[model samples]
Target chain A: MSARVFINEVAPRDGFQIERDFVPTAAKIALIDDLSPLGFAKIEATSFTSPKAIPNLADAAEVMTGIQRQPGVDYVALIPNEKGVERALACGTDELNFVMSASDSHGRANLRMTANQSLERFEHMVALADGHNVFINASISTAFGCPFEGEVRPERVLEIVARAQARGIQGVTLCDTTGMANPRQVASLCAEALSRYPDMALTLHLHNTRGMGLANAFAGYEVGVMRFDAALGGLGGCPFAPGASGNVCTEDLVHMFEQMGVHTGVDLERLLGVAEQLPTLVGHDVPGQVVKAGTSQRRYPLPDAIG
Target chain B: MSARVFINEVAPRDGFQIERDFVPTAAKIALIDDLSPLGFAKIEATSFTSPKAIPNLADAAEVMTGIQRQPGVDYVALIPNEKGVERALACGTDELNFVMSASDSHGRANLRMTANQSLERFEHMVALADGHNVFINASISTAFGCPFEGEVRPERVLEIVARAQARGIQGVTLCDTTGMANPRQVASLCAEALSRYPDMALTLHLHNTRGMGLANAFAGYEVGVMRFDAALGGLGGCPFAPGASGNVCTEDLVHMFEQMGVHTGVDLERLLGVAEQLPTLVGHDVPGQVVKAGTSQRRYPLPDAIG
Candidate 1:
């Protein structure tokens, strides 16, 4: 397996979209600018969804156009349809991450469309981005399993992958939307996906809802899946999925990979410094562990009682 | 690798010992009684230490004698010295888990003894249990890394294991006292321990301080170490180590294993029922995720708006 892993910071999009209070437009821009130099392969800057659906990210265009873009980092935006693609292209997004669900029920509940309908929208969206010099990626939500409809078969997920590939998508992120993925299942599905779609850029987006976030990420890493989508301070969760919490924490993931001798290309000190500001940013405690408990290499002074 | 994993519940001993208030004697007994029939291989009922040291568990004797012992379950006690071993034996403890630290600084700070001194005490403690029909296990704290003294070498850990074995210690648990262990280091050390002490019943005791608990346990499992020490609701921490919090959660660990087709012999539904009562019992919310965000098998209803 490869020793180097790619990380996509998704807090700005996945995390901010679920927050109760709307983060100020300037704060969002400042946060993205802070993350730009942190060696992230990509940053999901914002979603160009309708303000009526997700008002938290209503300032998506301001966030996308305001931040100072760092070289070697791709600025990605979540696009639900052709309109989203148009708005994202207008803001000069480096990547367009088209979103859909593997399960029909979730697609309707979340995206207001079924899988086939989403695919049809994707074809038009890809045509809209034809001359924009943007990378097109498809994120298949509930790829592991579904909340309403249980046990999304691997075959169903693969069929969606095949359909996305037929629509000219360059990358695919298998999202365990509600933290329903187990390590064994992740390894099996990721290994099969790697085998079937060798040319596709595969990314694993996981949630820590059941406390298996890092474990699932490790499972995917063991199976040769290199790219991972994590939120800062483990922010962002599926509101539709009850009890759903933070995404896999970005700093925590980097700390684990760096401790394992794998190359994450992240400056841990700088990442942690940014993570320390998350609770204040969100006005609540986040689920991330490493920010509270220092990294493994952290040393504590001997107890004063010790003689 | 074997699919069968043995879980030793350590919430009573580990979790209670660190709480700010002393859990009522009857409450502790009731908790143990609830866990008895849950199909755990062993349960660390309490620690036989001085009342002044761990005031929260001062009623260890009452807790041990009060619970109705279930057949096929081993009730274990953490023994710090000869007096502890005698007290545990008098309470009819099924196992005597001798506690030590691989690093001298932590041993002195936590146990008031160095590794060598703890080993010397273990020899006498094992001798005390010679006539009793009890299993002898030694827990080497900071086997992964020490907070005060970072990077406990693998060879140092092996030497302690060798010494413990020479002293009639039948089982050993390598503890990540402050959650400093990474999966790669865990795999390497656990594989070495399994190879060197094939006859010894090896267990991995991990903390989730840095969010690598399940990942470390999985790494150990991948290398044939089947026994694990976990706390109910992810309670417990090392007071001597700053920023340390929670052991690996018992239900979460079992959930992950059962999801992966590994048999934990634990009735998870019944276990979750017990876990649900943890917050009220502990007087606060716990770090456990599965207890709050139901297992992966949990299914939520679709949004009412979705028609």
Candidate 2:
């Protein structure tokens, strides 16, 4: 049997946050409820950031509290600071995902704080969850490369991981915020990170901006990194990264992994069914290919001339 | 330094053949002329098949004879039979890429011949080029899986390779004609083929229909298969495979390889300049990502808020 992989769906938070129009609170809840039984290891249901910054997900508390959670699936909420952590805890979030940036410029541009400031704030955020029964994950944005500051050194990313670990964060997601990562860099970084912190849950958050998302994910997987963060229909893009595209499509990722004989524990047919509804929900076509073209298992009839 | 890889541009033939409106002969020549100086290892200029079958490429001779060929680039023509060989040789083609399908149903549907029939015809075709100073390659279509008949066994593909070698074919391309291949399957087959016939040139032809194209290419690269067949702006699709999209985008493939530190001889900046013209030439938006999202080296100014 192939080793099973973990997928964390982030469309609701990461994907919806960037939409021009706010996804209605009930629609968000309905979507999460629909996705809960699909066997994802985790679902980032919403973000508890300031409404002024990300108005699309202003209904974070409503989304976190409204969805009927399923057992064995951790419902995660993106928490940016101590107040966000407290809000997520009040909504009974299963996991608190702390957000930061590896590059100081990106940290300042996106979150109005530098890397050091974010790390300093992570301490207070983690402290807010001390008595609560919740998992903590720190997402290091632009860990691969920054749009404002290009070539974020692997050393900087490792340093941030080390700092997050020191703050009692159990997991770290190395994000390619602008889809600037290549497969070789991914393999090297993932291998080094896995070797150094074998106990920590290291997740890969890749974007399809330059079309290297799956390739980078596979590289990470080849180097023993198991968890991945993906969005439905490849939705989500960093507003700061001009001309950038979406997060790696959840269905496409699962389809590729399943086709490669790796177990993703995802019901692909059911997942694709949900993926098909994305365009209607978002009022636009998405960047996903698997939903547009069926899975590899799909067989077509011979051309009419042959038949 | 990373190993140098070969990229064979296939847009002139594989991409243009499927277009609804025939690309004018002069335009075809112009495109090929523009591409010749970009340092492609080989360019499949056009197909020498009967115009009735592929009307879009009716000016195969015009395209082949019109282009100002570069010294380092080999100009290839898709040869379906002895007649194609005769025509390609008349056009002074550097290489003749003979086409065949691995599955009998696909063979009959696409080429009106079974695998055995195509192989038997290869002898006559090879004999036609016996005295000519031209390289010969066989592209095994649907080598990974057939849309009609699913799951093509690895043994069957190997057998076809052996037969092609016996018939004096110098290179073979394992084509996922309809994007049905997975990375694990690609790696395993490529490893086996390379081990058994270390002398023969092997190439991978993938499609992004299901979004595993670059990942499959990387898998093949990891196993030491160095040559790839990509189309400009991800043009080309299998007509027999319903809902299938284009071949892997050439610029995207090159970007990934270059970013990973692998040296592809082609100049990427010049290639992207050509790729940017694809939409105007083809009268449609192309699937390539690198052109839309600049290379990883691209940097953006900090947002107005930060500045």
The runs of at least 3 residues in candidate 1 whose Cα sits more than 4 Å from the true structure, single-residue gaps closed, are none
Q: What is the lDDT of candidate 1?
A: 0.92
For model 1, how does the per-residue alpha-carbon lDDT over B1-307 read when each residue is reduced to its tens digit?
A: 7989999999999999998888899999999999999999999999999988889888888988989999999999998999998888899989999999999999999989999999998888888889889999999999999988899999999999999999999999999989999988999999999999999999999999989899888889989999999999999988765555699999999999999999998999999999999999989888888888888877878788986
After TM-score superposition, the amount by which residue A261's alpha carbon in candidate 1 deviates from its true location, in angstroms, is 1.0
The positional error of residue B90 in candidate 1, measured at the CA in angstroms, is 1.1
The lDDT values for all models are 0.92, 0.92
Error of 2 at B44 (Å): 0.5
> Candidate 2's residue-wise lDDT over B1-307, tens digit each?
2288999999999999998889999999999999999889999999999999999999999899999999999999999999999999999999999999999999999899999999999999999999999999999999999988899999999999999999999999999999989888999999999999998999999998898899999989999989999999999988866566699999999999999889999999999999999999999988899999899998888888878
In model 2, what are the clashing residue pairs, if there are any? Answer: none
Q: Is the docking of candidate 2 incorrect, acceptable, medium or high quality?
A: medium
Model 2: chain B TM-score relative to the native chain B: 0.99
* Model 2: residue B194 alpha-carbon error in angstroms: 0.3
